[model samples]
Target chain A: MIRITTPLTDDVIKSLKAGDSVLLTGYVYTARDAAHKRLVELIKAGKELPFDIKGQIIYYVGPTPAKEGQPIGSAGPTTSYRMDPYTPALLDKGLKGMIGKGKRSGEVIESIKKNCAVYFAAIGGAAALTAKCVKESTLIAYEDLGAEAIRRLYVEDLPLVVVIDSEGNNYYEIGQREYLSSLK
Target chain B: MREIHVNEIINAVRDLCIEANYYLNEDIKNAFLKSRDEESFKLAKDIMDILIKNAEIAKNENMPMCQDTGMTVVFLEVGQDVHIVGGNLNDAINEGVRRGYIEGYLRKSVVKDPIDRENTKDNTPAVIWTNIIPGDKLKITVVPKGFGSENMSQIKMLKPADGVEGVKDFVLKVVKEAGPNPCPPIIVGVGIGGTFELSAYLAKKALLRPIDKRNENPFYAKLEEELLNLINGLGIGPQGFGGRTTALAVNIETFATHIAGLPVAVNISCHATRHAEKVL
Candidate 1:
């Protein structure tokens, strides 16, 4: 497995490939359907974003509320496709990486390739295990959105797979084909 | 007739909600272990291990297995001989959901309006289905359905000419299109032979069955096994990273249909498929 930190650069992204397992450390921003809509709206309106989009990863999740003495509740990636309509805009703004599950639109894949960004897939439904990697979580914007609110999280050794790399190699296609052919 | 108080229903629903979210059912856990051992791909096996461990953590910590605590779906089998007193039945069920989501620290995922899109905050107004039964008992089953899987579900209306092959094709198409989205290895609940709405309901209800249990009818049970094998052959694997375990099971429930119609609904559920039951 490859070990990588946040603020992914062109060189780091280029080195990664589809089907590579990754251990992601450092900070990632939490955003889901509501937060993505707002972020895109701000960009479209020529307004300042809640946080800098450069050199950052966005995890599509709306986590359960943290219990007493817990940093966060069961935290894991939500489906990524729901954010597809707004992803290209974020990618254009120098967003370095995305962490979520599921396929992305062709448009988003093109943007990922053009912007030299990568898409990571954390194990979907592995929320309790995922939460253990979260060191800290601080709300950044859109507090009224509740679980959909943007939170900056410090994650350590969070396991992820490179589902789509900067060159636009997609693991979903390649992995499935390889497995199916192996059986034949 | 036996008298049943609304308070009992409320409290039972509340407890069931918490229990369902916090505890991963034994059937699912065993399925994961069995799949993990049988999975051919190393990464797929590892993914299964993570799922198994996640369930363990959720149970031990008394936290939800997944963050999407889901919209509460309550199935009520109310006895025809019982009289419910003291409050409205729907209100009691909603109250149970409200308390469970709030007190259990679960996420409130319901919105007041689908179009207007405002959070209900307390996860009220659960999607409830009630059926009248013969006994004096009431059976409450709470299935907190995560939208990650729910969104991937589909329904199709085929002509009677489409037959079984048509049903198989439609199910495969849905699973293929769903890809990695619904968090495979998914459990496929298929409802066939009913009208449009009834088919959809039966599909969802099929999910409530234990993964290990086959359909009671010999024909449908065989069809279930066949579809399951075909799905596993798709190579979606765990999380769609590709392997032999795309689907853990395929459950089909059928009902009488009109002569000209064959409506099918495929309700895809993630491996974290959760539900709890209580009888009062």
Candidate 2:
């Protein structure tokens, strides 16, 4: 498994390949459908984003409210395709990685290749286990959106698998094909 | 006639919501363990292990098993012989949902309107489905449905000529298109026959059945096994990592339909297919 940190560099992105297991560390920005819409609207309006986008990973999650003494609730990746409409714009602005589950649109894949970004899949529904990786979480913006609000999370050794890499090699395709062929 | 108070229903619904979210049901946990033992691929095995461990953490820590504690779905089987006193039934259920989400620290995922898209804040107004039965008891089942898998569900209207093969084809198409999105190791709830709307309802209801149980009808039970094998064959293993355990079970529920129509609905549920019940 590859050990990587957020605020990723071009070399780190390029070195990864589809199907590689990764343990991601450092901070990741949380945003879902509502937050993404607002963020994209800001980008279009030439307004500054809530946080800097360069070299950052965006986790598509809207976690449950944390208990009194916990960092966060059962935090797991939401579906990624829902954010497909706004992904390219973020990629264009130097978003280095995305952590979520499921497939991305062709347009998003093209942008990932163009911007040299990566897409990682967290084990979806493995929320309780995943929350253990989150050391801290602070609401960054859009509190009215509740769970859909944007929060910045400090994750330590968060487990992930590269689904789509900088070169646009997609593990969703490669892994399935390999497994099916082995059965034959 | 038996007299049932609204507060009884309210309290039952409240506890059901929290209980359903925090504890992973034994049948599902066993399915995970069985799948893990049977999964050939390393990654798929690892995922099953994580899911198993996640459930343990959620239970032991008293936390939600998944963040998308889901939009609350309450199914009520009200007895015809019972009289409901105190307040309105729907209001009581919604009140229960509100209290459970707030008190349990569960995520409130409901929006007031679909298009306007404003969070309801308290997760009020649960999608409540009620049926009148012959007994004096009320059965409440709460299912907190996460949109990740719920969004992947689909329904189709087929001609009577389409037959069983047609049903199989549609199920495969929906599952394939859903791919990794619904979080594989999914539970496929298939509703065949009935009108367009009833078919969808049956599909959702089918998910309430435990994974270990098969359809009561031998023929339908056989079809369930066949579909389970075919889905696993698709190589969309756990989280679509590719293996033999894409789905833990394929449950089919059917109702008599009109002469000209055959409506089929597929409700794809994630590995955390959560539901809890209390018969009061």
Q: Considering every candidate listed, which one attains the maximal lDDT?
A: 1
lDDT of 2 at A137: 95
Q: How well is candidate 1 docked (DockQ)?
A: 0.91
lDDT of 1 by residue, B137-175 (tens): 999999999999999999999999999999999999999
Per-model C-alpha RMSD = 0.8, 0.9
Q: Model 2's DockQ? A: 0.89
In candidate 2, residue B252 scores what lDDT? 93
| Total backbone clashes of candidate 2, pairs 3 or more residues apart or in separate chains | 0
Write out fnat for all predictions, comma-separated: 0.88, 0.86
Error of 2 at B32 (Å): 0.5
Q: What clash pairs does model 1 have?
A: none
TM-score of each: 0.99, 0.99
